[model samples]
Target: MTQLITERSTDVIAAEINAIKFQTQSMMLQASSEIGKRLIEAKEQLQHGEWGKWLKDNVEYSQSTANNLMQIHTEYNSNPQAFGNLSYSKAIALLGIDAEERENFVQENNVEEMSTRELQKVIKEKQKLEKEIAKKEADALKEKKLLQQDIQDLKQQLEDAHQQSTDHEDSEKEINRLTQELAVAESKAKKLEESLKAKPIEAATVEVIPESVQKELDQLRSKKNESTDPAEIKFKMRFESLVNEFDLTLHALDGIGNSETKAKYTNAVHKLMDKMRATLEGGMS
Candidate 1:
């Protein structure tokens, strides 16, 4: 008997091996899915307490194994074609990903070519990244809420300051009106005294300004002189606003989680303070 020898190129051999691997993986996936489906049916028919005993006696499968198989069936049974290149181990490992993201993750990562351990590592990393992103988003939302509250408080303070300014202006106007009225009254009194003096009457009753009125006029004049200057009021308002803004900046700095970023901002704030101090000292000089 004579046997024929076959010679194949490396490329042809590699292609053949890959084809075989693909067929083998496809069969494995189908077999596991079928087994899982039957196990699910069996569990449904069994009594509530007999599930473990049935698995042990009938199939020698532990509850954990049965659970994994049922879960695999539930996840893969709907669209097995999409994952036809996945081996049983690969499919099982892929279960770590959510159903919604599994297809896209598999396609993007070429999960069919990855080992089970590699797939698990990638899944863990992805989960960790997602958790970090969610935490950052939550922190950003909280910061936004705090900033909005701070803005609302600042607006209220501005409104109050404006109302006070308006009241001060009204008070100044009232004082000016009273001064004008007092001047008019004094002029009329002086004219009446002059007319009496011209008549030379012996029993002329002269109208005299009351002591209380004189004192009240003096008090009004003092108050007018002591009233806050408009420019001074403006300066005070601006200074208070600057102080509040600086306080808000400090508050914002407290929320910084990165030490390097916080330190940078702290240094900037110190420089700004030094500049302001220098400017103020120069003005005093």
Candidate 2:
């Protein structure tokens, strides 16, 4: 019999709970008459923003408390074309028993407060933030353009400098090449002159150097013996020696006497000496 008593008690509690829920739902539906006009007036007063969506979600969650709000949320969400379907009487029917219940619902579910000025101020702040973002974007674009131009100018300057450096190097190399060529030409000219001096090549002329003429040449060869007893003879002898030495040293390479013809140098010297002797004898007399 103890098991039977426990089952009966459980049944009684369950019935009481069901009855309480029904009464609660009935009372909430009755208050909608007062709240219906107020809710519409609030929605119309403020331009809808995030708060509109918040209100809609809250109304959907209100299903556990009452049925009217849940139906409204479902209808609004499903059929966007079915607007303004709320009867003030129907919304008033959905209002709960007292202000305490409404305040608790608002607090727990984040019901938004309705103020046009506050909503408008928030919108203005958002717009200001958007404008600041646009300005920052424009400034960054301008800075990027300036940086790109600087990079371009640096590239041009680098190219010009490189060209100048290449030109300078080419010029220096050319100058060095020309200098080397000139030195080579000068060296060739000097080598030719020295070869000419080293050569003991024969001239075309054949001058006979007889013993008597050679001995006579030796006597009058020195510059001191050039002045003899007679001033005229001394002058003539000096002139002859001067002519011969000048021919041998200065004009030896010029074609004068050739191999085919010969001068009897001894006979000429004897003749000159005899003339000198005559002139001296005449002077002494």
Q: List the residue pairs that clash in candidate 1.
A: none
Model 2's alpha-carbon lDDT is 0.42
Q: Which stretches of candidate 1 lie over 4 Å from their true place?
A: 1-4, 9-11, 47-49, 155-285
Give the clash total for candidate 2.
8
lDDT of 2 by residue, 1-285 (tens): 455543568789999996775465445533442243345555566575744554567554232333444434433333322222223233233232233343343345332342334434544564566566566445435534543553454355445545555556654443443333333333333433442354332322222233565465445433221232345444544544444443344223333365333245535546776998899899999
My TM-score estimates for the predictions, one after another, are 0.53, 0.23
Q: Which ten residues in a row have the lowest lDDT in candidate 1?
A: 200-209
